[model samples]
Target: MDFLENVVSKERTLNPEERVGEALRQAGVSITITSITDVFAFAIGATTRVPVLRSFCIYTTAGIFIVYVLTLIFMVPILSLDERRRDSGREGCLCLRLPADYKKNRCSQKLLLEVIFRRIFGPLLVKTPVKVVVVLLTMGLLGLNCWGLSGLKNDFDRTWFFNPGYQRDFVSAVQDLFPESGYRADFYLGNTDYFREKEALEELFNRLSALPGIKNGSIEFWHHSFLEYLKEKKGKPIRIMNVSTKAMQLTLTRRPPPMWICKQADILLNSVPPVGAMNHPGKISPGLQYMCANG
Candidate 1:
């Protein structure tokens, strides 16, 4: 309005409506489509592993929508005051091409975009056989992609963040030497009274035993073996040193060495007690040696 009134046509001034129409005819649609492409790029990039792009996309989308709505509402009036003669017979002139003779078949950017985006998809949507084939191909591709994704396992190797060969080889060597390997889970009892809450603990143990992915014989509780030992002790007195040990000593060097010294020697040597006819609890005591104290 300012240009037309002051500079271009001082005598015959152009109205606001005429100016808006002229602006739209010149570059509005092209600008709108370019903005749409930008928004699409932002949206798709947001879906990928890019946080800054996602934030920019969100702000850009909101800003674009707000300005677009405000412009449409305020500037695009229904009534027209100017009578500018249009050459093209097209109704919705959103292609944003320059006004020219419609008879010429010369291709423009707008026509090329229309042909690729609209005309190409239009036949695929309307035609039955093409639509069916496209849908089947799409479904097959989706399924194959899902299957491939399912095969991707989560890898958290420490070497991934460090120098690959050196750190990885060092770890592998350590594992090979002192190969301490086991699956263990710890449960904090806090200040709970274990004797008073035996039933709850038993229930918890049963639940843990029933859990999936737990090896059949892997679950171990201190109380389980302790209770079994108590049960066996209650049945009969457990012989600390059997007659065979004394007999073997008599056969070799008699005099019957002190029981305390014998026990210390046996423990230091990690002596495996022979399985006798009497099912003694001493045989199972080695497995009961745990790092965590039940009390």
Candidate 2:
């Protein structure tokens, strides 16, 4: 639209081809700069870790690039054709030849808004008093925006991205019913010797549980179930006790020493069972055995 306006504003003495060439010469730098700026700005979004945002950015960047290319390739010829149509006194789209008087009158007349801006508003805006007022108002807005930034809370609501469907309704219902449990963060432990670092792992879990906004008994580590199984089988209370070398050997061999351990392993591998009736089932538990096996 801006490119077409630039072409149309060229001297009436110039032909359509000359006007197009002149418009490109005058507006090319600005067009290129703005398009490049927008492309780079959206390209930055591609670096985000969120899959949806990253994909959006990637597609938007490509789209902007393609549109920019198309504009350069096609707009000049289209603008030249429109300019010829205007010069021939033909109505746009309809291609009807307009009356000579009407064409002349239209060509000579200026738009009321353009006239008002040029003669009144534009001149008034340049005056010292109005300029000072404008600067003050702009600064006031800037200050308010900066103050508002301090109160901005960073949050992600997955429901906002969902369309109107069963998935969206289900998520909305869950969020309404259990606001605290709606959003969660998963922590992964990799390549650690759980037998040796059991205490450290427990301390880490306890600290995570103690953090503000973490629901009580919400932390689920498969090691907890393994500990329970050991306590029951060995007929003793257990807290941070490293398993015996024989038990460790059994674990390494995938035998687990007992049918009960195998049953517990199946449960651990499938999902992290709830700690108690009050707690929600842990959805993020990748079993210790799975992690160790992969690592």
Candidate 3:
């Protein structure tokens, strides 16, 4: 659109090819700058961790590249062809020949915005008083923006991602009723020797429990339950040595362990109970799902 406007706004004395070339030259810098900025912005967005936002950015970046290529390779030649048709006194889409006097009758006219900017705003902007007022207004706006930034707070509402429906309404109602309700955070450990690192893991649990803003009595480490189970089974104090034989037996087994044995093994060697499970009182068992280790 800008290219077409530029071509039309050029001097009527120029030929079709000259008008097209001049328009391309005039519009190239602005178009290139805008396309580069847009592509760069979306490229940064593509690196975001959020799945929806990353996908959106990736598709939009591809679209911008495609459109930029089409503008140069396709739009320019089409505009040149249209300009040629106009110059030869042919109708715009149909190419029907018009009267020979049509070219002479048609006069090049300035756009309304171009006329206003050249006649009124251009001269007014140069006057000393007008320049002073413009500077003062710009400074005032800058100060006001800074003042607004000081009061701005960052917040995210999960409901913002959902459309207006029963689900969104329910979530908004819950948030309004329980503004202090906690959300879940999951942590995973890989290739850990839970038997050797028991003290380290216990210290980690204690540190998590000591953190401010954590709800009291919400930390649920599976080791705590396993310890109690062992105390009940052996009628002795909970210690890693008591389970050494069972751990060895499981490790030396040729066949896969039973489901209950697998669950116990997962709790002993791999799992840590979720920290904030108490927040969801209605949930019967809110912990990591245990999977059996393959033999």
Residues 1-295 of candidate 2 have per-residue lDDT tens digits of 5555655665767888888888888888898999999999999988877788889999999999999999988976888888889888898879899986773556546568778999999999999999999999999999999999989996766677789999999978876896656354456554455556667766776666665655666656655655666788779986666565446435434555444443343222222222111112222232121111011
Evaluated against the true structure, the overall lDDT of model 2 is 0.67
Those runs of model 1 whose alpha carbons end farther than 4 Å from true positions after fitting are: 1-112, 118-182, 210-212, 236-295
TM-score-based ranking: 3, 2, 1
Minimal lDDT window, size 10, model 3: 276-285
State residue 269's C-alpha deviation in candidate 2, in Å: 13
User: How does residue 96 of candidate 2 score in lDDT?
Assistant: 96
Taken over the whole model, the C-alpha lDDT of each candidate is 0.48, 0.67, 0.64
On residues 1-295, what C-alpha lDDT tens digit does candidate 3 reach at each position?
Answer: 6665666766788877788888878888898999999999999999876667889999999999999999989988988888889777788668999976654423355367778999999999999999999999999999999999999996656667899999899977866786565443344445455555656655666675665645556545554444555566568786555456344334323232233353443343222232111111111112212211111
Encode model 1's per-residue lDDT on 193-269: one tens digit a residue: 33444456556666666656445656555434433444464586433222244233232233323332333322121
Candidate maximizing TM-score:
3
- Over all chains combined, what TM-score does candidate 2 have? 0.57
